[model samples]
Target chain A: MEFQGFRRKDGSVGTRNTIGILSTVVCANEVADDISRHVEGATAFMHQQGCCQTPVDIARVNETLIGLGKNPNLAAVLLVSLGCESTAVGEVAKAISEAGKRVETIVIQEVGGAAKSIAEGTLLVQDMVQEASRLERTSCPVRDLVLGLKCGSSDTTSGLAPNPALGIASDLLIEAGGTSILGEVTEFIGAEHLLALHARDEDVGKQILDLVKRMENRAKSAGQDIRGGQPTGGNIKGGLTTIEEKSLGAIAKAGTAPIQAVYEYGIAPQVKGLVVMDSPGREPEILTGLAAAGCTVIAFTTGRGAPQGFPFVPVIKITGNKVTWDKLRDHMDMDVSSVMEGEETLPDAGKRIFREILQVASGMLTKAEISGYTKAMDIYTVGPVI
Target chain B: MKNDAIMIHEKDNVATALRDIKPNEKVVVGTGDKSSVIQVQQPIPYGHKFAVRDIPGGEDILKYGEVMGRATQDIAGGTHAHIHNIESLRGRGDLER
Candidate 1:
């Protein structure tokens, strides 16, 4: 139940000690990326947000950036600002600094221009990375872990094998005192009532129902039926028939744990069991959303191979389809197709997945991370870029 | 049990084909008398579902013991059940409820 991890000064255990270069506005992403390109052990969280239209969206962008900076994975943070963006760079940096992580800020206009900001930002992140490098892995209990769950490009085998296996792993993690976050409220549409039955209380059950309804209504309000788009073409080709069937299969990834809490997109979890967050079912946005919510490790189940990974976290790609496992062997981290082939039991595959999670948390790099396929990611923003 | 097809729940009307099942193939659902053979009506591709019993058009397709969708065409028992034969009933814009 213990893994080697960097213990942050804030008393949180981190699976990775990274220096994050975050943009205060979309205009500053290039500088943030430039800084990360030059600094070792540093990465940029470049998103097309920060100079947005609506007040709610601007506030959401700022809060998500703050949470990402406060995540245990980041040993330090460097804020890259366009100087006049809506996001309050000073306030965000102050909050992160209060949490005991090394925080610094560089403004483009204030520092002269984009070129000047990049120069200053690179030097700052270099110093931060070196400081982060000084931290060493120590004894960290599994209870301190926040494991995020996601399933993408699904097929029938996903529900039959890897998903149930992941569910078992989710339950195992929860029993060991760790937290597991299940997001993608959009996937729970047809199976919302069923999933709600697993909530810890009536209130939580209602919240689960509300989130799914809200997600569906939001699509309807946009003048589009979720059915027209969901159970996507690929899903149908892969044998999925309805949103309910997909949702039924999708919920299996959370295992059999009771829903402990429900949260909005980009918000951190407060309770420690199985928490579900409101997020769309896309990889880049939802993956970034989960990372911002403070999950240090992510387990992604795919029946069709999904290769995207998070820049700041290790993503364990598990597949239950023998065809996909063979075609995308280099991308997948674990192949649990034996469960479907009747050669292995679900619990056995679940135990293997659990062991893989622990090993990855203890410094093992996944195929996606090793192949450097983790850089294209951004925060989830639903509003216009005006 | 090592299964060739699994009924996720007892009330489900469809069972997922664990592998590619040939036409007229017998798929075992449970143990001995508690089990029954569902003869395959067509080549059910791996990971797809088959009608455990005949389903009428316009009827709800049940899976995992819940209404997954509505059948678009009358489906014979053991025939492939997919998007070609089902339409989603949830998340419809014109749905009043």
Candidate 2:
């Protein structure tokens, strides 16, 4: 029920204690990446929606940036700003600082250019990294762990094996008073009604239904069937017949916990136990949203094999397909394929996944982390860039 | 406890093949204490679903005890039930104006 973690001054616990180099706008990504590259124990979050966007999306970018900075995994933060972008850089920096972490800002325009900015940011990041390194691991209760659940590249075994196994793990964590976030609203298409049955109240249930309706409406508004994009070609090849079938399997990741609350994309949960967040099923956006929602660690179930990880949060890739496990050994962290073979029961497999989660939270690097396959990241934004 | 195929819920009319099931193979499908044999009418690829009972055209395809979609054509028991035979009822912009 406990694991070694970095205890943040704000009372949250971190599975990793790294310096976060956050690009405030797409224009500042290179400078931020350069700074992170120069400093050990520093990771950069480079996103693509800080300028030329609707006010709603711009606000979303700013809020997501603040949420990322507030994540306990980052002991300190450095905002790399393009200076003229629409993102509220100063507000983001202040908000992060208020979260009781060291925060600094470097404006590329004020620093002359990208080259000079990178140099200045690199020095700032090196200092922050040194400060972050001073923080030692301490034992933190499972209650402090915020777990994010996601499944991608799903096939039939996904729902029957790893997804349900992960569900058990989520249930275990919740039973121990830990928090678990279920996202990927798009995947809830067909199974929303079933999920609503688990909601703590009628309003929460309605919210779950509404999130699915909104997601489906968005696809319909574009004058296309959601199936054309969802249940992707890989999913279809993997034997998922329709969005409804995919959803029934996907919802198995929620386990049996009562849904505590529902939140918009990138917003952190207010209550503990099980909650839902609105996010598309794509890896880039969902991972970013989960990170922004303050997940200390993420459990990603993939039937086919998805390799992406977050630059800061540790993503543990689990698979239920024997072939995927054998072929993508470098990307997978755990194999619950035994469940598919009926050699292992779902709860037993779930216990193994829960144990792996604790181990990863205690600093064991997942295959994704070890292979450095953590760079495909982006902030989920709605509306067009003007 | 049949290992060849699994019927997740008792109400499910379809079962998922744990391995490639050839045509005419009598596959045992069920979980725990409840199980039944289905003589497959067509090849059911690994991870694919096959109707455990005859599904009339336009009827809902049940999996995991929930409606996954509607059968587009009459699907005989033990035949592969997939996108070819079933279509989702939700998010069908094709049905919209």
Candidate 3:
């Protein structure tokens, strides 16, 4: 299978060819945002990181920024940095340039102030946007696609309908020699055992189990139950009784593909097929993590309607709740509620979703993208901000 | 007409109501060869679960043919089964010693 995409020099295929105005620290966000806001073909990645207490988190911020810059969706990148921040701005720009993308840097402190920084950044972004506009879509095989799977605002129908349907779509993509990433380690509590059964080897299976154990311990260390926050109020009101139930349902999005490998937060996968990335289930963190992992497109299944998208990668919103489909039509991209009605089989629904994915990959804008509802983004860090 | 409820797996003792079902309503759960009719004992809201068979207290509640949690109290067949009567067995820090 093939879709029209922007073929990057690094051999990655981009569904959207846009310039990225990335902020290296929280202090440079306004400047980066202003730069992207003034450019038509530019998007900004603003996050609250780069300066913090721990060396671990600062390193993570630098690595994540490099990954984000390497993403094929960005034809070129302009990094906004605060000169005093701990983020390795030079290394990040060098790494992205090494990935075969044009990269420029603007230091807020060195530029004399925010106003001057934005002015300089805007001109840089405008040039990048012009460079990006010259790239035309070309036919790219499905194998070049890296798909990210996520489910949120779940209800009971999630397990039975959209999730399983998405699972089928994931399976189809994998069968086509594409890659799909499954994150949300916290949602694997009771179902980790079942998921481990799909691992490529004993070591991979053990890794999956360890991720779940570590995620559970993080909550337990805080002297609280994970269930207190998981299976959120909307999930409960939508008929999910326990986190176990939600986990069982959520794993359905992974489909039946073999788990090839596991990766840390924001790390790109080395192997194809279905892989696991360590990330929480929150929209902001997970979406950013997926984007950093080099995913050009994301499939988000929501039973109660989640509207967030990434600035560059197009997030396709799908749902299985008919009521949510009717009420939140503006947010949803596809509906597989017919699976619940028994009018459409799982495989048929899966095929339909697969087609939608191909269309979106070929440059069709998702509702979230069209509505510009994609600003809630953040980098996941283990340490507290200083 | 659409089935009133759905049983994901044959081993599942609970069925999810496809629509709002009222007390004493004879809800047809599942579809085709895998379906059965049960007299609902209480109002089951849309998307909520109801015990398709009687479940004893502290017994495992099955869904998608896996243990989702344990019932807090004996739940009669055809009645609602939810957080009020079911508790997750995993990730419970309060249970840690």
Candidate 4:
């Protein structure tokens, strides 16, 4: 139940060690991306939220940024600031610095322009990267591992095979006293009761129910029924008849473990075992939420297919359908198609996935990591663009 | 030989067709006494479901041993079971925002 991990000075364990080039606002994304791109051992945290929001919403933005900066995976942080955004860049840097990592800042307005800021940011990133590169991996127990679970572009086979297989793997991880995060509040629409049943207590169950209700109502507030979008055409073509069916399959990623706690979008899990996060099902949003939640790795289950990866975390794409696996072999990391083929059992596949997670945690780059598919990521925002 | 359609649970009335099943193609459900076979009444695409027996409209359509939805129309044995016939019984328009 132990895997190689990087020990952060914050007394937390990290599965990956890298310097993060974090932006204070969307306007500063280019500068952050430039710095991270030009420097090795660095990843950019590009997001599109900073200004024009209510106080409540802006607070959410700040909280998530701080959470991301505090992620143990980041050995050091070089924050790029546009200097006028609502997100507290200084506070974010201070928090990460207090967590015992190298922290530096480059403010565009203060530095005169984006060009000068990027130049400063690049040097800062280079120094942080060099420092991060020297960190070594040590044996860490399963309890230190945090696994983020996500399902996207799902077909019927997702619920039947890979999803269930991942559920088993999730259960294995949780049983080993590790943490597994089940996100995608929208996907829980028709399956909330089932999910609530896994909650540790009645209050936690109510929280699970309320989160599902809130997410559904949020969609409804936009003036449309969620059913119009639930079973994506691909899901129907793949044999899912209703939103209920799709959700039933989607929830399988959490396995049957007790829901230990509930977390909001971007708030990292504070406890061990299976935790649920309030997040959308989209790749960009959920992936960012997972990374902010401090998940060391992502277990992405897909039946149809998904190829996106987060800039810092390693995304391990798993598929249940043989056809999608064959079609997207280069994108997919593990194939649980044999479960449907009756060639392999679910528990066996689950064990194999757990082993793969250990390997990925031990620095064996995932397909998403190897192909450099990380970059198209963003933090989730509930409020409008205005 | 492996079953063409996978029966996920004993209570499931429909089995997922392993491949794109053409009309008149024989679809095997499982092995042993619980197993059954049906003829594909229509073209069932890969990853789609087909009824193992006739299902009356308004009855619960079971999958993974749970109520996935309710059939909106009578579906004959081996007919494709999908949105055209099934109405999601939970949380679509049922919840009050």
Q: Pick the candidate with the highest DockQ.
A: 2
Per-prediction TM-score, chain B alone: 0.84, 0.93, 0.94, 0.88
Error of 4 at A58 (Å): 1.1
State the weakest 10-residue window (summed lDDT) of model 2 chain A: A219-228
lDDT of 3 by residue, B1-97 (tens): 4589988888898999999999999988884456788999999999999999999999999998999999999999999999899998888877784
Q: Write the per-residue lDDT of candidate 2 for residues A1-386, one digit (tens) a residue.
A: 79999998889999999898999999888889888878888898987889999999999998899999999999999999989999999999999999999999999899899999989888888888877788899988999999999999999999999999999999999999999999999899999999999999999999999999998988778666767588898999888999999999999999999999999999999999999999999998999999999998999999899999999999999999999999999999999999887789998999999999999999999887787787768988879989
Give candidate 4 regions above 4 Å deviation.
Answer: B31-33, B90-97
DockQ of 4: 0.51
- Measured against the true two-chain complex, the DockQ scores of the candidates, in the order shown, are 0.58, 0.79, 0.75, 0.51
Which 10 consecutive positions of candidate 1 chain A have the poorest summed lDDT?
A: A219-228
Q: State each model's CA lDDT, in order.
A: 0.86, 0.91, 0.92, 0.85
Task: Please provide, for model 4 over A1-386, each residue's C-alpha lDDT reduced to its tens digit, 9 standing for 90 to 100.
Answer: 79999988778888889888888888889888888778878889888888887777788778877878888888988888898888887777887788888889898999999788888888888877777888889999988899999999999889878888999999999899999999999889778899999999999999999998898777666554455477777777677878788888899889999998999998878789999999989898899899888998999999888898888888999998888889997899999988887789989999999999999988988888778787777777877777
DockQ of candidate 1 is 0.58
- Assess candidate 4 and give its TM-score to the true structure: 0.96
Candidate 3 on A1-386: residue-level lDDT in tens?
89999999988999999998889998888888888778898888888788864999988888899999999999999999989999999999999999899999999888899899888888888888887888899999999999999999999989989999999999999999999999999899889999999999999999999999998888677666566588788999999999999999999999999999999999999988999999999998999999999999999999999889899999999999999999998899999999888889999999999999999999999999888888768898988877
1 or 2: which has the higher DockQ? 2
Query: Per-model i-RMS in Å?
Result: 2.5, 1.0, 1.3, 2.9
Candidate 1, A378: how far from true, in Å? 2.6
Quick one: ranking by lDDT, best first?
A: 3, 2, 1, 4
What docking tier does model 1 reach? medium
Interface root-mean-square deviation of model 1 in angstroms is 2.5
